[model samples]
Target: MDVMVPRVAALPAAMELLDRLHDQHGPLMMHQSGGCCDGSSPMCYPQGEFIVGDREVLLGVLDLRLFTGQVRPDAPEDADGVPVWISAQQFDAWQHTQLVLDVVPGRGAGFSLEGPEGVRFLTRSRVFNESEVRALAQQPVLTGADWDTGARPPAATRPQVVTDVADACAIPGG
Candidate 1:
């Protein structure tokens, strides 16, 4: 069986910030900014607070547990991680690249939950190699529409990764 390539992952810094955010704000969600005030930074929010709409694409669920060494009270009981989303248009433009959620020292987007934390989420991307692109082509892409209907990736695919290199060198995109 072929494993699907994860579309998103996170760095250790991001995981640490997320752990702090999760502790303060609860389960979290991340969205790629589609030209918000912060340009294209990844925006983090408390889960269930942002109502993702049909135009949003669920890139992948990021399991930060390994990098942060913290078990989140993540909401999606089935996934045990945070969901990362992008606008459908943005996904179309970035389909060939994989996202890496990194953290930088700065104020986050005004509307994002991390604003007060003095750290902002950043999105670093890499173009996929031919084999990875091919493998990803066969993978199912989930969307907000599917989520609203209570759909989720099967258990096998749900643990989409987001870990630091030292912690998870085995996870390709992570």
Candidate 2:
């Protein structure tokens, strides 16, 4: 069976930053900035610290062990997974791309967790190739609008489908 390609991936430095932050904060989550002051930087927050609103989108989850090169005996099956979110409006703008998280020198001008660490999390991306696009098409995408009231898909249930993306990537509520 072919392993699915992740829609989001992290560079080494970014993963290192995540490890340090995880040690300090216990757990963390990330949200990709749509634009404005932060540009497209990825903001890391304590898990559930930032209220995911109706305008945000759930992009995908990243495995810390895979990216951080670490293993913990106490880690649960899903313990290493970190959720990555983006604004639905932003997802509409970059649906064909893969978000690559990277870290760079200098304090982030925004409130992202790394701002005070002298490094800022930023994004670099490339358009998906035809094959990647085909594989992505088979996967489900969740939009904030469909996740009304900011409710997450129940853990024991299958992901809810907001709408079919069969018509050339039109966002459900766009």
Best by lDDT: 1
Model 1 clash pairs are: none
Q: Which stretches of candidate 1 lie over 4 Å from their true place?
A: 68-79, 155-174
Give the total clashing residue pairs for model 1: 0
Write one digit per residue (lDDT tens) for candidate 1, span 28-115: 8988988957798788888877889887998887765645454545344533367899999999999998888877788865688777
In Å, residue 85's CA in model 2 sits off its true spot by 0.5
Q: In terms of TM-score, how similar is model 1 to the real structure?
A: 0.82
lDDT of 2: 0.70
lDDT of each: 0.76, 0.70
Once fitted onto the true fold, the runs of candidate 2 whose alpha carbons sit more than 4 angstroms away are 69-76, 144-174
lDDT of 2 at 99: 76
Q: Residues 1-119, candidate 2, lDDT per residue (tens digit)? A: 14454677666677778888887886788999877987777999988887887667777766677654666677675555567899878898988987777778988767888878988
Task: Give TM-scores for every candidate, taking all chains together and pairing residue i with residue i.
Answer: 0.82, 0.76
Q: Show the lowest summed lDDT stretch of 10 residues, model 1.
A: 154-163
Residue 131 displacement (Å), model 2: 0.6
List clashing residue pairs in candidate 2. none
